[model samples]
Target: MQISIIHEREVWDRFIDQSPGGTIFHKWDFLKTVEKHLGYKLLPYGFYVTDEILCAIPLFYKNIRGVKMLFSPPPQSGIPYLGFVLSRNCMNMKLSKKSQRMYEMGKVFSDEVDSLSPNYVSISLTPFITDVRPFKWNGFMIDPLYTFYFDLEQSLEDICNGFNTSKRTAVKKMDKYNMKLVESKDVKQFYNSSVDRYREQGLTFPIVSIAYLEELCQLYPCHIKVYSIMDADDNMVGGVLASEHRKVTMWIGSVKPSVKAPVNEFLFWEFIKKSKSEGYQELEMGGADVPRLCAFKSQFNPDMYVNYRIYKKDLIGSMAEWFYLNVHRKKKA
Candidate 1:
């Protein structure tokens, strides 16, 4: 197998569409947006056997002082997962054959990543790609992470049946207030609310520039939508940012309203119905890792899915990760 940096946007995007684990985050424009806003170099890698593609991954290459680093779906980007996605043919292989192909792909990719000589490396694989033994064998530490998912195959009534009593009540109370949900292009307002929410809880919102938010809306006008909750007086109180695909995702939810109302719950209820109405097979409501978030997300009674984050660090790389968590995070996104 040969691993090469693929620069063709159409090729990369098409491959991502063909792979089961791939999300919009792995697509050409999204990575380019991250590179533009985060100032990290985006490297799109395609693993091939002779003339056929096997799998592909996106890595963001960055340098801090003198240490080089490589990360897929880099930390604090609020990107849930972005590693490699195998071809449909590879995914459909018989068990033993698939496992062997995965091993080979992993070995070749791991060796190629090593050849890049990054002092630090990190990767987050989507839940659909569960084989991490190859990375483990290649000397990377593997840790489990989780995300919440709702299977939208069920009817809306059945889907809501899983919600706890309070969540159900919250969903019902939106009508009492005569509130309405309006899809808008006001990403700046959404970014401000998100920033304020994060700051209120002493956590920084990952993307600092509102331009980044604007650019995403510009790039994916149809795929990404922001729904704002408006009052009887037409005041925007709460909203949600979501991206549509085979599986829809709740990317950002506005803070709770200043006045007493079920803002978040109402937004989710409407969004879920919309996603289901649009015929998406699933809904990904990630970011339940934080205790408070986990508590709230649990009320929706979503099933848990496992993903893995693989990391390796030399001494300086280890120190860099430490400082990044302990110090740098306190100052900037």
Candidate 2:
């Protein structure tokens, strides 16, 4: 096995499309947009056997306070998980053989990353790629994260029935408001609402820019949809921006603080119904680290999946972490 820089767009995206673990975050255009908007230097790598690509990982290099760091799907891009994308050929292999192959690929990937000699390295793997033992064995730290997923294969009634009573009640109450959900091209409104929500809580604004969202929406029209939840007066009270890649549709959205009409419940229910109608097999609600957010998302009765945040640090990386924990991160907290 050998590692090489993957420069060909068609080659990179074809593998991503065929990989079961690939999400929209792994797409070539998405990475290119992130690079153009966020100024992160792309350093995508691939593992190969002779002439065929076996696995690939997308990475972005950035200098933070003069400390060079590497990230996969980087911060503030609204991408939840993106690490390694393996070829579908691996899926048909025996379990033991597949594990061995993955272990080998992991080692190669680790070696390739180590060669860059960055101060810090961090990446979050997709939920489908559960084997992080190889990375751990290669001297990387691993942190487990969680995300919620709804099986859209079930009937709409069955999916609705799976929601907890609180969510059902909320939906019923939301119905009383006679809210209307309209698919809109208003990315600015969505961005402003999200920023307001963060500010109201004394939190930092999201890392990705409104321009990035707009470009992404335009780049993948069929894959991305922005819906506005309007009141009787046609005022935008809540909104959701959903992105679909293959069989999965993910919710990336926000709601107005003054609007207490359970717009989120209504918006999500509408999103789910639309996804089912469009033949999507799953709906991923993204991750909720905060207790309140988790509680609200859990009411939908979605299955829980674990994602891994793998990291490695050198001396400068250690100092960076110390500064983050003691100074930078504390200010945000």
Candidate 3:
């Protein structure tokens, strides 16, 4: 097998659409928009055998303070999972053959990533690829991260039954507030609310620019939905923005720090109902790395899935990481 850089948009997108492991983040348009708005250099790689493509990994190269780093799906772009999209043909193979093919593919992908000679390489693989032994063998440091998901295939009553009593009570209390959910085109409201939430927590907001959100919403209107929660007095109390791809929805949301009502719970309940009505099979409620966030999201009783962050670094990258962790992060603290 040989690994090469693939430049054809059609070929890349075709593979992504065919791969069960693919998400909207792996799409050509989404990555291209991220590149244009976030200023990351795109370098998409494909592992092939002769003329047939076996797997593809999208990457972005960036120079931070003169240190070259490569990221899959890039950081702060609102992309959660993106490492490699394997071919669907692998599903047809026997378990042994499939493992062997994946191992070979991982080796080739690792070699191609190394060829770029970036000081640091970091990627977060999607949940579908359970085996990381191949990449681990290639010397990448792995860390486990987690996200929560709701299966929409079950009856809505059954789904809600899994929710903790607190969540159900919050939803039930929504009627007293006279809250209304309005789908809107404005992303700045959500962005500002998110910033306010971060500020209230004494943390820096880590989202991409509002202009990027606007562009993404415009670029993929059918895939992206932004909704604002309004009180009876017509004030925006909370909002959420979510994107759908292949029957799964990933969300970003915020609620007003001043409002005392359960606006977030209402917003999510409405969104989940809408998603089910629209025929989506699952709703991924993004990550739960923070304790507060995990506790809040756990009330909904979504199943947890682990995501892996794999890293490879050179000597310069090690120094950079240390500085960022000890010096820069300390200063922020």
Candidate 4:
């Protein structure tokens, strides 16, 4: 079959929407939005077609060190966990002996990525195993970073049933406090309060600035959202900002001290309920701070697994990036 490089906006999105693991992140509009707002160089994407469009890797072309390569874009440069986004369909294609046709799809895209003449291509996948293998096959390195997810496909009763006693208690306490989740477009109060809370607790936040959030909101207006919880007095008690990627929605949460409420728990349930109502199948809690984050997320009855980040550098750029990280870490320490 012939593989064609598709540059037309409509053409790329049509294939993305139908791909096996198609996700919101891989959507043409989302990618374009990100590129337009964030100004990162995205890869040159193409379609792999035999009988039909089996798969496509949304990529952008880049030249680093006199070498050209195709990769997914604009994850913070020093961050270990950033990569190109892919649809769920292309990601879940099973690699079986009889699956020559399916395998060819990845091969074609892989060839295209390698042909970009860059040192490497980076792709990001959700925490599910069923969504990871496609990139692993194409010689793109894999690093399994652990993340947490909750499936909202079950009824609230079924979800609560899977929760351990401690988590159940947290949920009950949250409910008893009369805290309620509030959805709003108010950016200033949420952003300022969250930053203040982080500092008050002597914690370091790794999130981007409010300006970035504003840019993101404008870029993918429907995909990125902010939700908050307030007490009877209408004071913000807890909040979360989330992004929708394909069938899954993940959020970051924060709480204020005056609320004396189980705001975090309330926010978690709120995001889940909202996600499910919006027809999303899963809610991601994103990566946690090891045992602590994992333990807190466990209350939601999620599938916990390590999401790996694979790294390969041609010796030179690898060392530079590593040093940059180490220097910054040392300064922080």
Question: Over all chains combined, what TM-score does candidate 1 have?
Answer: 0.95
Candidate 2 clashing pairs?
A: none
Residue-level lDDT of model 2, residues 228-289, one tens digit each, is: 88899999888778877786555566543567688778877887887789888888886566
Off by over 4 Å in 2: 322-333
Clashing pairs in 3: none
Clashing residue pair totals per candidate (backbone < 3 A)? 0, 0, 0, 29
Question: RMSD of candidate 1 to the true fold?
Answer: 1.6
Off by over 4 Å in 3: 325-333
User: What is the Å distance of residue 299 in model 2 from its true position?
Assistant: 1.7
Model 1: residues >4 Å from true position, as ranges? none
**Model 1: per-residue lDDT, tens digit, 1-333?**
788989899998899898887888887998999998887899898889887888998999999799899999876566778898889989899999988888888788778878888989989889988889888887889989999888888888887888999998777676888888899888988888878877877778876478877888899888888888898899888877888866788886655566687777887788788888888888888866767778888999988898899988999998998898889998764
**Ranking of predictions according to TM-score:** 1, 2, 3, 4
Cα lDDT computed for each candidate against the true fold: 0.84, 0.82, 0.82, 0.59
lDDT of 3 by residue, 1-333 (tens): 888788999999999999888887788888898899888998888888778887888889999878999998676787877888788887567889988988898787788777778899889998887788888988888999898888889888887888899888777777888999888887888798887886776665665688888888887888887888889999988887887787656566653356778877887788778889989888888647778778888888888889798999999999988897778755653
Candidate 4 C-alpha lDDT tens digits along 1-333: 356656778867776665544555666666665555445566545544444554455555555555443445444321223333334554555656315544554566567555555554455543333334555676657766666777778887787778778667787677567677776788777778876776775553444456666666676667777777878778778777777766545545454354556677777767767778988777777646456566667666687656555433566546545654677544532
Between the candidate structures 1 and 3, which one is better when assessed by lDDT?
Answer: 1
